[model samples]
Target: MLPPFTEETARLKVQLAEDAWNSKDPARVALAYAEDSEWRNRDVFLDGRDEIVGFLTGKWERELGYRLLKELWAYTGDRIAVRFEYEYHDTEGQWFRAYGNENWEFDERGLMRRRYAGINELPITADERRVAV
Candidate 1:
């Protein structure tokens, strides 16, 4: 039987996600998902860890200088919700701050089996620049 989802587990999941983003390694981040995981990131839909890794690699490549910060919004049972804000400069030197929310469903083993994310980008002005923590 699967263990109950507690506050500790929810907090740990958020921390793990943050750590994975900080690592900036697509392969390593993909390991947090199940083998057949599915994701809807922005407008892209992907299945399986390999596809997930590939998607992330491509994203990081195009969205150069990427940095992210994720915060736990809520969690219940095996599902977790997060709100994230990230800043990245495109290959052409356009800077943006992307704000998004993600809903995640995890399997019994704590591997994310499904993810749905929605994001919107806003151009940042030079005077509005703020460092990510």
Candidate 2:
């Protein structure tokens, strides 16, 4: 059986993901994965950090003005699960909230070796998604 995860580890992993997303830097985010990491995001399967970086770069380019928040769902040993919500504006200024869950498995060296993500998008009204100043 896999070992239990400490609360601290779970929190840290979530924080790392959040920071990486906020940075909007694909290269930086890709470094968090192992050299030959495997990933399935939505329906696309990608392997290796280069592909991860390329995918993220294309994603951010198309999904402009992206911002995200992730919450820890569960954890076991070196694997962690999380659910996330994100808001982004498409090329045409239409706003959407994307809800998703991810399963992540890290190797012995704390580098993520595998990731599986499921995502869906929903349209949001301007008032519903507005940020108060």
Whole-model Cα lDDT per candidate?
Answer: 0.86, 0.87
Per-candidate total of colliding backbone pairs? 0, 0
The regions of model 1 sitting more than 4 angstroms off are 1-3, 131-133
lDDT, model 2, position 2: 24
Best by lDDT: 2
Model 1 lDDT tens row, 100-126: 999999888888899999999898864
Clashing pairs in 2: none
Q: Compute each candidate's TM-score over C-alphas.
A: 0.92, 0.92
TM-score of 2: 0.92
